[model samples]
Target: MQFEDVKNARDYIVYSQGMHSYSKAITKMMDLYLSYVPYVERAHQEGKKAIFCSALYPTTWEAPLLYALDTIPYATGEIGRLSDFRVMQIAEDYYQFPIETCSMVKCLVGQWHIRKDDPGAVKRILGVSSGCEPFNMAWETMKMQGFDVHNPDVIYRAKGVDGERLENLIKFFIRQLYRTIEWVSGSREFDEEKLRLEIQRKNRLLEKMRKVLELRLKRPYYIRSLPTILILNSGVANYFARPEEFEATLDLLIEELENIPVDEEENKKVIPLLWVGTTAQEFGIYEAIDQAGGALLGFRSSPNKLFREDVPPLEAIAYYLYDNQRAGAEIYMRRFLDEELGRINARGMILYGIIGCSYNSVEREMHRNYFHQKGIPSINLEGAFQLGGPTGQVLTRVKAFTEMLS
Candidate 1:
């Protein structure tokens, strides 16, 4: 069990305390807990200027904020990520936005919509845009909820950026980021040398975090989500001002990682199954796979990575400031079907086809054939993400598939 001070809203603090104390509801609430909460908190609280950024292709535009704040970073993801299973309103209270909105995205947006008691949210919310309807729709949803959303930064999908264009865009992003910082901090005199040094420092940190994740992937070194969360401070624009907070959060999580037992339970050799498609399914699907002796190694039928901003560093901050959304739904589909499918050595796929997401909604024919040619079994279930069916078909199909594999 990890030990640390909680920094989210009081409920989150209570949620954290409950988990550490081994409270009965912990199992149910565990998924909502920000595995890297303290680390994210630390990043924002550091002494330097801070701005918060959130997105899919964060590698791009976030760079400008990093340079501008001399320390700002990404916030850890919203509390209820796509995978939470236990149902209950921990974050969104339903008043912030219409319940008709996509539940998963709304789970993240709920802070502005349903759960508005916390005022700090107004201080650091920056939403990104991808070239998808839902991306803009979600932004609108936030706006409807009264969020002070600035114009979205976009990411393009025509082709992944490369070479000179990438360099120019990156430089442009830095200049735009300066404008944002000036607006927020109400001070225009930022030190140039500090910005450059911070960028170098950030590059080193991204590389280090990647390496750490690689290690965790290899040996259950499981960095405990803290360091990655700290790295996201780079994504959040305001963390620069609160370096200590980011550092503290990082320390708490890293400590958790170091203390974790090296032993990971052996997975069941169930049918080689793949989950294709996005919109986070109810929690425990992955945990179920792990506990039931099976694995959903990768996503297959899911939407692409939404709102990615993997643009090159800006030549001027304006380049960064512009919206450059990617059709993550489209990208993830091609990569999964066109690329990752054959590689995973899967026997079947569980495709959760979400409605209203045009990107993947149109790919049904392409994916079905794509997997079949690869000689993989697939099950398509059409329904709201968390609520599949009462007869437990999802679980039943999973069990049957695994039994067949065995």
Candidate 2:
């Protein structure tokens, strides 16, 4: 779709959803999603390989390797907006998957079923071997279906492990990275210069995002909650393909934020809040918060940190993959959450998770109890990752939570 078409879609979404403002950045993000499949098709035509990934994997861990090998990256998480529910239903019905399966897995499987016969679609998947059973099983199903699937052995953090154990884990992860690279590129060695360039590009993007995040603290929120969530989602997933377009979009967003004037009356009504846990797929949650006079100041799913420049690019990525609290120990996750809440000066939090996501279900409660003990109010909400939007019950809880915060 063209830029104007994307802009019109964004406007319709905002108006239909009863959201507060329009965002050029969010429009560009929609454009990128629209452009993705065509880009992959063209890349395949030009003899470039394509690899599929889930949003569960850190983009930092995979983007550089893909770029160095000149491969196009397509993520199941990045496909479609409102149509995700239809795709997800196809997976559930066709595969006879249980209703309790993670929605993302069903969505991925559904996408696979729909595109399995498409010659230009990616058949090679980079899968994760650890964390989230449903996700792992989805990859296994794809492998059985004749797709070329490679699951890199990755482990979650263990308690009381440090020093030698930690070193060994990092080293093992680095080896897996190499194995994945070799599998995708058909070569044991990748161009270091290309990897370094991708690293530099990523760093530049992070710096820009940091500024946008800082700007989010401003009252009357020049950028709305949904746009910010979308941006952070892209940040965590590293855009994977054509990241430059995303970077340019950020520039426009930053400029707009810088020039926009804060509404003093709205600033007085704004109740700054934090969102913690799985990404909120429902657009209505943000609108509910807006309706309840809450401004989302920050969001955390993964640790908010940058890759190190002092170390080799690969080593830096490996370290981030190993240490980031997204998949790390409870202590690290708690520490990260506490620091982020304090940094954004959040008055309250929204702890969200997908239905049937055991991993996040446990996490949501842990975070709720932790924040409760700290005298910070938080409400936990669980819902499907469906496209039509959250149920009225979910929306009521979100609005009530934000209203209480206000």
Candidate 3:
């Protein structure tokens, strides 16, 4: 289905046929999309400077800078459309970009080539090279292709190993973020006040997000309500523009959600599946689960205590980035699951073993063992990056899992 404008496309995507009902999840997503798509389009139209991040980056610092310049910040992996995904295939098959590389990187780099001829396309990139070699290599290739690039070197140190050393590293990252901000600002003077306001607004946004997550964990009703595309579009494109409006929408959502009581019978009808693995890019995996009367609660492993509303923006962001729970380190991952499983009242766990992700693939057995010991059955489903799975087989497996839980 095609739409005449971006807003229509966004509307259709967010309020798709079966999802036309009014729900807190639908309302929140609509609010986000209305703000998100237009902001990116306006930035593209006005020739405002934009930066493409290679992965998820802290937005408290990044988004404010873009807002200051009247620009937009985008995550290459999260923002890719279906066309971009197809371009990634062409890039791998025809252009000889490594097929074994990360799907996010492959699609993002491929999207760059597709948009390279357009004068309006964002040419500057901010690449994070701390983890994922494919992402690092993709940025290197983009640099070679003449895109202006900045990559901050970050090393992962296990928490509590060296407090002072960690503080020093965070300080270094703060400096790198400041430098990147200065560069992104171009001729405009860097505005600390604007950044402070943005950070304050983002703090509210995070608070709202936390509330939303908490609600979901407590009453996991909206799991399959929104498509992975819409969910991830907001996740990736969220930082591109307005913070206050975004926060307000979130506030509205939380208020609405708080009043809604859990439907015990409805909840009993379907199995709630706690998903662990890569971003479910296939989206069909989710649809299949829905068809089989399962709710797919996507990955959640945040160290909420590490972030503070009153903390310095740089420190908060650094802490967020450094949080092992956010990065899915083994110890923290186990802890996160342990904490969240009961909250969501999940019947089972599904570990999506991505082909290229050594991290999740290797941890599958450990996760299975852990879940099994807890008397919760779990299964490991293997697929390519971003859930590149055979649709029929994936659906079959999803049905089988649901049947088992039933």
Candidate 4:
């Protein structure tokens, strides 16, 4: 498929013109997303390997490593976002993947099938065996298709472990990072200074992101909900490829938010909501919420911890990944949700996820019960991630939820 045929490129262009059209910063972000695939293709022409990663893996650890290896990083989840239902259909219909598979995995495999014959496209996948079973299975399937797949076993048992065990787990993960580096670069030896510089650059980007989040908190409507979601999405994966360009876009957004005036009358009419669970690949989810008189003030999945500068760089990455994985536990999520709800003064919650994700299926009831005990109103919305736009049922449910909140 051509670049223009990608769903995100088309949607992002419409988004650029439709919402907050006055802000050149949002347009710059749209351009960044549009430029990503071409950038990877260009790098491939330069003989750099394009390595596929997952959003589940901490970019804090992987981004620096990929930089040091002189490779380009592209997440399948990011590709899923760029694709439309046609890719998902390819996975479901042609590949014979069960309809029960996670939407992102389907997109991942489908995208690979489309580009597997292309010499310049992604041929190497770097995956972790820890999170999301479907993603692991996807990697295995791609491996069966003769793609270069390296999935390192990183233990994710972060809860109920003793201090010694936790320390051991961190050491194991650090070793796995080296193993992955060796697998990608054909050697374990990488420039420590290059990795350290990439980490420093990542840290700077994180600081700018924090500023953007703070600006959103100060004036949620000033920036709008979709842009906030996109920002968090891009920030999660270290801007997909180019950290410097992503950082520049954040700088632009921060400046625009600081200068723009909050629409008080409009803000007064909109109910502030908190989004908890996986962000839907369907961009229309945010738009639906906005049309229903709700604005997503904060995301539960937003990064709360920064890499530790006081520790050794590798150790910091290990700890960050360990802590980050631990935060996915129910214990951490409960406290985090409460803090975010209070922080943003959100009136309601939107619990959203893909239809076939086991994690979301299990967490849906738990989250609903938890919010119930806290007397917070929430609505659960489940659908295929990138299969088309938001369903009418989803839009009606959102409208009802926001009306109830109002």
Give me candidate 1's TM-score against the actual structure.
0.56
Output the number of the TM-score-best candidate.
4
Q: What tens digits encode model 3's per-residue C-alpha lDDT throughout 69-177?
A: 5556665645544334576785687557777765666776777777666777678887665757776777777777778888766666565745787778778877777
Worst 10 residues of 4 by lDDT: 1-10
lDDT of each: 0.43, 0.71, 0.60, 0.74
Tell me each candidate's RMSD, in Å, in order: 8.5, 3.7, 4.4, 3.4
The TM-scores, one per candidate, come to 0.56, 0.88, 0.82, 0.91
Model 3 bad stretches (over 4 Å): 1-17, 24-42, 54-70, 84-86, 93-95, 186-189, 217-219, 222-233, 236-240, 301-303, 309-311, 382-390
Q: What is the lDDT of candidate 2?
A: 0.71
Residue-by-residue lDDT tens digits, candidate 4, 1-406: 3323435435644654456668887777766766777787787878777787764333336776676678777756666655677888788898788988988788888888888888767788888777588777777888888899998887666468759988898899789888887899888887877777777776776677767777776577666677677667655464757776777778888898898777677667768898886657666667667777788987776667778777776777788777762443655577878888897788999998888888877787898998988899999888675646667788788888888898
Q: Which stretches of candidate 4 lie over 4 Å from their true place?
A: 1-9, 56-60, 82-86, 93-95, 262-266, 325-328
Please report the candidate that would top lDDT against the real structure: 4
Checking candidate 2 for backbone clashes, the offending pairs are: none
TM-score of 2: 0.88
Over 1-406, each residue of candidate 2 has an lDDT whose tens digit, in order, gives 2213322223435453233336666566655645666776677767788787654333346666676678766665665343467788887787878987888678778878777777767788887787477877788788888789988898876776678998888889889888988899787788887888877776677677778878767744666776667666654354636777777878887887787776777677788888876556666787778768897776675336677778877787777777666656654677777888898878898888877888888878888888899999998888666565577898799888888777
Query: Residue-wise lDDT of candidate 1 within 45-140, one digit each (tens)?
Result: 454333444532224445444545554444423333332323213323543334444545544554334334554333355555553454456566
